[model samples]
Target: MKISPKARMNRLFTNGGCLDVAIDHGVCNEPSFMVGLEDMPRVVDSLIRAKPDAIQMAYGQADLLQSRPEKDKPALVMRLDMGNPYNATRHRTMWSMLQNADEPIIGALEMDAACVVVNLFMLPDEPEMFRQCVENISRVRADCHRYGMPLMIEPLVMLSNEIRGGYQVDGDADKIVTLVRLAAEMGADIIKADPTANPEDFHRVVEAARVPVLVRGGGKEDLKTVLMKSAALMAHGAKGMVYGRNIYQHANPGAVVRALMSMIHDGADGEAAWQVYNRG
Candidate 1:
């Protein structure tokens, strides 16, 4: 009905690349001392000062984003799932709350959402589960196409007690490359992926997928570490970054956002970005 996804893609990228700030964690984890996303308006305001390309968040926060006085604001990316970290430890997976919500998608489109987002989990040696993941996206794909919205699928690697935290870092490039290929072929307009831990290996992930690949923020590492890792990922052909805590939870959220955008969009190294952050 609308050619919004294309425009949203453009809204989320500039001459350099995309630096999308993700604040949708509240849907799953809720507002804890750690997340600090319960007040959507305040958090959105904090990130807006940093001037990101887009802000991906749950549809519930749409009104707060639209109310901003600055018309030249970042686009909205509507998250369509929810999961809790406390519960995540139980399942050892992030998408424990994955669901197909028709109402939210409709509301998001009405709010001028740039795109609709979903997450899928695929473990190694689980053909049945893999099929299930595909089937879910297959359904969403049809709806997004009909509405002329873009679908971004995050095909996560198998989660287990393998990583230090209860997160999905498969530590296997082969699996990531395979997953990226799977998501792309399965009809993802954009793919947000866990880094294969190395640029060369992640580059294969970018190369394997037909859609553009953006690196995830992963754990709550320090800004310097995140920026350094982001630079490497971008060098390896990553289109951009979709980070949450790394951008907002910092002491100065605006400075952190600026630093990340400078690194991502202007080719500034981590240290250079850090210096800019320190100055502001």
Candidate 2:
């Protein structure tokens, strides 16, 4: 997938600085997220000032951002689908709301976004859903191309772990590498995934991906840990970080963003970048 000028700008902005502020929680089944509907305005305003490379949110949220004045806002990516309601009920192999395809294409156009992100979940219970999803993603990605908006994919093969009351998945390097290959074959412009727990294995995933790769944020590790992991991934030639919870959940969102930016864009060492978190 060829990166557009806007996307190239995105690479420069984010790879130069850790990508910040993904507001797609509402679609992810976070019923009581620390950031909510009412929180959008303030958070959006602050993030705009803080200047993240891009903001990822559902179509509705993207529309909200579009309505805002564009004095100092960052670029936007609309996450086109929400998980199946059954995900919360049974945690089973489930389909997302945008299974239909057309809805998300229209939403992306309406929001005037640079790209759309689709997540493909590979789980034990629903193998067929994964195939169907890949098919749908191919179609949607083609549609995105028609409108000149690139489609970014985040392929998730969850680990079946419990973090707090929610499920967390460990990264499987091989699985993610395969997912990236499939996305590229199906026409994805960018991908966000977790690095394999093993450094060498993670590097293999990155190299195998060929396309630019960004790391997803999910854990509750401290700033130093986050920076170290991000740096390690970058050192392995990963493109950048696509983070959310780490920035928004931190007590000092600005400081955290700044720290990540230093490492991502400025090539600051981990110890120096860790100061951003420490100052926070």
Candidate 3:
């Protein structure tokens, strides 16, 4: 049988690659780094105006999501999990379910959601953490099928330091490949991951998963750098990217979002995207 729910989600994207905005940060972290997102409604309004192909938001934002004025608002990727400090070996890296992993999917179904997403940390040494990750994905995979919704698994491989930039190191490429394949084996319709610094290595991640792979927008990279890297990612077979801080933290969020949309959907190079951003 065709995965029709996932295939039909193409309606949310343009004819080209996807440009997805992730507004789910606040629920997992304090609002310190999210300059514009502290004003949730305003930032949501800005993002909506920019017209991203899809958006990822926390389960708590259901009311705000429903209140959007646009009948054709972007597809909703409901976050089905939350982070707890105790879930990870490093207290700061915790990404686990808020309640039962299925709860958010159930609520999202009621809102006519397009997809459900959960975060996982691939820790080979910690059997309990590994088991929890597997259990969460397995449970959510079943729930998605029963509800006829698409499921997205976001997997990260991290070291013990809890350093934000640590995962981008040299060995991250192979580890991400492992994570991608693992997510696929667990039955994810889509998988989100960090882009390896070496652009070509990202293809290993895409090829390994054999599923749509969208790179996560980690930390607050410069707009030009992110757009440049996004071009490289798309050239190397990435589906697209999910950005939170890069878009929302900009002085002109709508402009930044539009620039990224141009790059992702229109295939504009970094210079062209910079021009689009500068034009505003």
Candidate 4:
């Protein structure tokens, strides 16, 4: 029996939204991103217990989550690309490239993944990098249609600045909206995008993408801030969130995930979500 793409995509949502935990930072090659992920098994197990709608992971580590014998495991979103823009410690030319182009969709099928993610980056003075990202998405989109798999496009606007000592997420609304719309136009089944600098402007991103837009949790922030921002984004039409460090780097990852779930599914405001986080 084969599952349809619509069915696989439906599994990634609950009550009209989703909360996807992202542990795919290992491929970024940034040691700072590895803080809570030192033990793969423990991290994966803890996340499973947290029970997010899905878990986004790179090819190598995805097995740790999907191999579980339990019938209620989180759906997997396999990352099909790797990039150097996340390397913050040293100065280097930034690049985002696919790990494998030819058989990525077939490989995801073999892994029983529900969806695949690839990057569509907008970087300053890096037209070539942007072109490469567009090409990768085009190739992946064809395979996704062929295999009946959902494709999630992560469109980011990044800048190399001394303040962050490397490429950092840029929240410029115009840039983000343009790239997000482009990603959707290019055939993204789902769009994972960063919130604009002004929370009110995020609706434009959602409108432009014309798809289920999931907010990207960039760097780690204080609990209250994260909850408040999430609430604001959701209020402005975001479908949900795809959080990385904000969940995994917390003192209690599971607690944070549950709190976020309350916001995504239960219409919990920031204060209510904060109480949920504290209870954990």
CA lDDT scores, all candidates in order: 0.74, 0.70, 0.74, 0.88
Question: Which ranges of candidate 3 are over 4 A from the true structure?
Answer: 1-3, 31-34, 85-89, 92-95, 101-104, 123-125, 162-171
lDDT for each residue of candidate 4 in 42-129, tens digit (9 for 90 to 100)? 9999999999999998888988987899888899999999887776554456677778867767768888988899988787677878
| lDDT for each residue of candidate 3 in 1-280, tens digit (9 for 90 to 100) | 3336755466555674677789887665554455677788887777777788888887677557666768877878788776543222355334465445436467777766778788777643555666677778778777777777888898877554454323322237888888888888888877888788698898899898887888888767788898888888888888778888788887888888888888777878888989999988
Model number with the top TM-score: 4
What is the Å distance of residue 63 in model 3 from its true position? 2.1
- lDDT string, candidate 1, 43-104, tens digits: 88877766788898776677788777798888888887654332334443333344444543
lDDT of 1 at 241: 85
Write one digit per residue (lDDT tens) for candidate 2, span 1-280: 5324355335335434437468787776655455534477777777777777778887766766778878556777778776752232445455654634655578767767766788777755667668767766877776776666767787776643232234355576777788777767776667777777875677776666666777887755777888888888888877778888788777778788788777777887788898766776
lDDT of 2: 0.70
Candidate 2: misplaced stretches above 4 Å? 1-20, 32-38, 85-89, 161-166
- Span of 10 residues, lowest total lDDT, candidate 4: 87-96
Regarding TM-score, does 2 or 4 come out ahead?
4
